[model samples]
Target: MRHAHKRCEDDGNWFVHPVTNKAWSNYTTCVDKDDLNFRHKINKLYISGYSVSVIALTISLAIFCYFRSLKCTRITIHKNLFISFIINNVLWIVWYTTVIRYPAVLFSNKPACQILHVLVHYFLLSNYMWMFCEGLYLHTLLVRAFVAEDKTMKWFYILGWGCPTVVIITYASVRSSYPEETILTPDSHQTRKAVRATLILIPLLGLHYIIIPFRPEPGSPEEVVYEPISAAAASFQGLCVSLLFCYFNGEVVALLKKKWNQVFTSWKN
Candidate 1:
């Protein structure tokens, strides 16, 4: 969905609601009506954005996988980045088509949905972790060219895949303690978003800020207002990474051009 709150314990403001539920309920129409509109918006904007991202990401992945010469440490990490986005997009698509579209399943709260819920965020955290790895690799290679690439990649793997589990476990543990309807179960949207932002920022300077999700009223159905920060951050991940790591990369572009020319020359022959 275009809604950022879907994946997290809750990205639904997705943790950045400027208005309280008491105020929200005052002006908003029927709860079901608002939720319906939200669902429609999510399916339209989120699905379309993610679809385009998936196509672009596939092309980016192919560029790296097909070219043996371009398989350097940096580019390998780029492939991992693309792979993370790919998995995230695919799982989200599965969520939309399978669980969400079928209202009965969503409200039924099937075990599969819970698994999907966990998986969706897991891969998302994985994406951030790998991006952190990307920055780390860059810094290491630039400052110390003598370091062994394999060792560096090994460490990257452990951190990128391992770290998110801690967050997810903490999230699930905290969420489990509360009743299902409680808003606190899912951490605040901005809190989760800031965590991802912090990962990208931590290496730059020593500055750190811990922002958590802004929880809504305990039982207010209308508390789930969508926020652009979490929504845009989560939905547009594939597009951002593709542009940053693959589409905009000098090496990837050159390789793609070389492949196109080779294909064109073969066609002419």
Candidate 2:
């Protein structure tokens, strides 16, 4: 495959590989192939990370939902957030196993494929919105500790779930107006601060390159050398949320201790 890009001499369009002198007629083939390979590697890592989060979130949800004593406004919010994580992670796994592995399916414009694409992104955005809800809930608790409002969760449900729909619908509407596969100009891509931040800072583990087989997309002018950084970050949701909201939870620890003591006492009897 590496030598498939060797110069044809009939057309000198492709930039020659310095070391191998490989230059194929359709340079974008190698680039797209590399892109596909990169996503494949990220899928493995996503599965591992997302699987851990699903386990943690499952435990967290079970503990909170099963125990009546753990019921509180904050815990309610946490449960909802964990639900979002569950959905987001599952959707991402579905995406990687199906769409990412078979990107041409996206080009097919199949109703199911298009719906899956929308759903994966919708839940992804919903996950972020739920995180915002967590932050907002925490802030509300701190700033308005005395102000007891029973309808707080109601409004939160609206903000967390409702707002993401508006944004996604607007996105779909705008995108539907445009042609398929519209590549962003260099300047446009540069202005994407969120994307830039994810690409630069999120993959701190530096594991993307290690997992991905070396398949350079040198022919692609728009493809970054480390594009997998953004993809990995985008796909690897829920793990941090699970760790923060469940594993390190003092309340959950106390509940576990209480339950353990109850079981031990029964056994002694």
Candidate 3:
């Protein structure tokens, strides 16, 4: 996909599109059959990645919910983060399967599609916000030896869910005033065994956004490497987070093992 921009005039007005005769911030670039096929493949990878993430997140969520012993401030925060990711992934899956897959649905510019567009971004923002809450909570715990869990949790709830609502409302209100524009937009190593795990997992967790602004020019040699890396980072982020925080967690692993052994011994008896 290409990113085309309209330059603002010196008088603070905007440049208009020649075809639509309306002020536009961005416009889509036309692509050939080869590019279109490439995009289809990328989008399929996205669907598959997101589907796997959703399944992993759902199972993680269930594990956290089922084990009453796992209840704590940290696990509570993890639950909310998992929830945000779950909703975000489900919405994205819907979007790719419906809006992106069907040119008619995308171009028809219906109200439902527009609503879906807003919902997708809203949850996307929530994903980051909840992540921020996670970091904040960790910092607070480390810095303040006796931090109040209830109070911190209240703020976390507001930041994780409420802040995104405010942002999306402002964005939607402003965007509603404009004409609809078409959608267009726009990794690395490890030590031996440890290095290989880091290389594979870091992108999956979407940590590659640290260099988002450094995107190479379209069709450049760098883009050849950038595209698939970016796609994997964005698509598999939820799965990676769940694996690290849930499935790979020592406490969670211990609880699951104990429960499994209990059930097995009971059945044997």
Best by TM-score: 3
Better model by lDDT: candidate 1 vs candidate 3: 3
Worst 10 residues of 2 by lDDT: 182-191
Q: Please give the distance, in angstroms, between residue 37's alpha carbon in candidate 2 and its true position after superposition.
A: 5.1
Task: Evaluate model 1: give its TM-score.
Answer: 0.65
User: Candidate 3 has what TM-score?
Assistant: 0.79
* lDDT (Cα, tens digit) per residue for candidate 2, span 197-221: 3343234223343645655565564
Cα lDDT tens digits, model 3, 13-70, are 8987555577977644644667678778888888988999999999999999999998
Which lDDT values do the candidates have, in the order given?
0.67, 0.65, 0.81
Q: Candidate 2: which pairs clash?
A: 5-23
lDDT value, candidate 2, whole model: 0.65
Structural similarity to truth (TM-score) of each candidate:
0.65, 0.67, 0.79
Error of model 2, residue 51, in angstroms? 2.0
Best by lDDT: 3
Evaluated at residue 6, the lDDT of candidate 1 is: 23
Error of 3 at 142 (Å): 1.4
